[model samples]
Target chain A: METLKIVKIGGNIIEDETSLNAFLKLFSNLEGKKILVHGGGKRATSVALKLGIESQMVNGRRVTDAKTLEVITMVYGGLVNKNVVAKLQALNVNAIGLTGADVNSISSEKRPIKEVDFGFVGDVKKVAHESIDKLIQADFIPVFCAITHDGNGQLLNTNADTITSQVAIGMSKLYKTSVYYCFELNGVLENIQDKNSVIKHIDSKTYKYLLDRGIIADGMLPKLENCFDALKNGVNTINMGNTDMLIKANDNFTKITL
Target chain B: METLKIVKIGGNIIEDETSLNAFLKLFSNLEGKKILVHGGGKRATSVALKLGIESQMVNGRRVTDAKTLEVITMVYGGLVNKNVVAKLQALNVNAIGLTGADVNSISSEKRPIKEVDFGFVGDVKKVAHESIDKLIQADFIPVFCAITHDGNGQLLNTNADTITSQVAIGMSKLYKTSVYYCFELNGVLENIQDKNSVIKHIDSKTYKYLLDRGIIADGMLPKLENCFDALKNGVNTINMGNTDMLIKANDNFTKITL
Candidate 1:
């Protein structure tokens, strides 16, 4: 199977223009079939605040109201996605941006109203592989924003991490898929404060130990859970590291194993 | 030759939810291959006001400064384009939304600083036909937003009419293309106040005579020019009317001829 890289970037890198461009330059040099997934919560929140839309957050997850969903669609799917595609084009990379609605690539079910009503939020149902595969075969790199639809004309706000994992899992049947979660940190750190304390590898046993020992608690728990889920579900490999990890030959990043 | 309909809708139709959906319902029933091009200037301007971004208009044309361009990308490419695609998907019309940057479908040169420095505005240079043809062949309706790229990392604000015309001209090489300019008006009215004064057919001579007689003037001039240019090129035919004109086969619309 041909190796395909699925890289997911958070708002920290994207909110910083210089760093984003630096990362895109490195990404443009990668020599294989790849896809880029992005989240734009920082800019979305800022714009929401400017527009007097109170962003309600419960348990660190955004409550996506109608207005908030519109903001994210504009910021994530429009401004950030297009800018990234254009910049990659300038770097001579053939990149095309997409929302799940485009080509019906990703379909989701609107989250059920629970304790907190996350209006217009969606949990992904599936990622259509054939449409994506066609673009890939035509030599176009797919760039995705964290927005989806319910196949009933409703645009739903989704988590970028899940999008990355889902896309990785969906493409695993046809390719040797490797998923990378790129962020501001170096990797899963042994010492959270120390930039040099990068953990090179973690298996299922090691992950459970880390979580039980509280070394991998808090916000990192769900992220790592997504990484492990992808690996368990046939995605060949999963890694977490800073943006430069891909450009440099060294696997200085944290690797997840089954 | 297989006939392809290229429909362009202005902000008047898009800014209204009921009308937009009504039009999409008719568009969904379109028999053969089709493309939808749209502009969202009203929403963009409203968004700019809410975000404290002062919109600058010179001679009724928006001077697209950097901030204005960003707003339009969010409004047109993100908010409007995705909604249209999702609605079409719900209607079971496989539709994919695109900016010029996506698939490198449209490339433009930034308008040079002549008298009015229309910052970040672009005049289209070329439209890539093969990528679009591939999508159409794969049974996906291409929905375009009036946002293009300079092919050198810059996203530019472009006019929707010009985009419609240029795309029709480009696609004429592979298909018998028919361009439709859908707006609030029924058609080119002989009397601006009378809705029934639709000029059913207009050739070059009739068009010139109308303009010379002071009947066709103001905003309609540039729109007519675009239609004539498309017809002058390889585009098979051009029509201007309300959205219903596409559904009703009576052709109670203005047909531009050379």
Candidate 2:
């Protein structure tokens, strides 16, 4: 099977122009078919603030009310995603920016109201792998933002990390997919203060041990969950590290294995 | 050759959700291959105003400074374009949203600094007909906003009318192309005040008569230029009318002939 790389960047990297461009330059150099997924929470919040829209976050998840949804649509789907695609095009990469609604590429149902009404938040129901495959086969690198539709005219906010893993899992049916989660940290470090004390390899048993000892919690918790989920669902290789890991062999980056 | 319909909507329709939705429903019912080209100037100006960015217009054209370019990217590329795509998808049109940078489908050069320096504005250079054709042949409708990119990485503000004519002319190389310019008016009116004064046919002689009489001056001047240009090119048919003209046989609309 052919190899495919799916690299995901967080809002922190997207917020910094220098870092984002630097990461994109490296991404443009990666060989073979690839995909870029991005988030724009920081920019969305800033734009919303300027528009006098207060952002309410419940337990680290954004409460995507009606107005917040519009902010993200403009920020994530428009400003950030298009800028990334344009920069990539300049780097000689044929990048096509998209949301779930484009070609019905991704579909999600509104999150059911249980503990909290997430308003227009979407939990992904399907990823149109065949449609995406057509674009990839046509040599077009897709750049996706964290926006999805209900296939019923509703736009919804979604988690970018979830989108990354879901795309990896979906594409694995056609190619051997390797997923990368690039963030601000070196890796999942043994100590938060020590960047060099990276847990280079993380297996199922090691992941449990680290979690029980409070070493892996909070935001990292959901991230690792996505990594493992991708691995279990046909995505072969999953890595978590800083943006630099995509360039060179970095022993400091954490690799997830079964 | 198969027929292709390129529908261009002015910003006024997009500003009102009810009218926009009504128009979209009519557009969705259009037979065979079609493309939707849109302008979001009103919403962009409003958003820019809220952001305290004073819009500069010289001869009815927006002076797209760096900040204004970002504003258009969000309003046109993000909010308006995606909403339209989602709505079209709900109508089962299988729409895909794109800009010039996406797949390198369109390319333009920055307008030169003449008497009035139009900052970051693009003048059409080339349209990637094959790239756009691939999407249409795959049964995906393309919904475009007034944005294009320089090959070097800069995104520029483009006029939607120009984009519509240019795309129609480009696509005519492979298909029988028909372009519809749907504005607020019923059609190009013989008398500005009378609603029933719609000009049914506008050939070169009649158009020259109207121009000499000062009836077809200002904004309508450039619009008619686009229609005639498209007709002169490989495009076979061109019409100017309200959105309702697409739905049925509207004798009130104007049809351009060579």
Q: B58, model 2: CA deviation in Å? A: 4.7
Q: Looking at model 2 chain A, report the run of 10 residues with the lowest lDDT sum.
A: A249-258
Clashing pairs in model 1, backbone N/Cα/C closer than 3 A: none
Model 1: docking quality category: high
**Candidate 2 on B99-218: residue-level lDDT in tens?**
888888788999999888999999989999898998887788999999999988899999898899889989999999988999878888888889879999998899888889898988
The candidate 1 chain A region of ten consecutive residues with least summed lDDT is A244-253
Spell out the clash pairs found in candidate 2.
Answer: none
Give the alpha carbon lDDT tens digit for every residue of A50-97 in model 2: 988997877676688998898899999999999999899999999999
Worst 10 residues of 1 chain B by lDDT: B248-257
Q: Model 1: per-residue lDDT, tens digit, B1-258?
A: 999999999998898899999999999988899999998858898899999999888867678898989899999989999999999999999898998998889999999987788889899999998888888988889999999999999999989888999999999999999888898788999999999899999999999899899999899988888788889999988988999887766678888778
Error of 2 at A170 (Å): 1.3
Q: Which sections of candidate 2 miss by over 4 Å?
A: A57-61, A205-219, A248-251, B57-61, B204-219
When summed lDDT is taken over every stretch of 10 residues in candidate 2 chain B, the lowest stretch is: B249-258
Q: Per model, how many backbone clashes are there? A: 0, 0
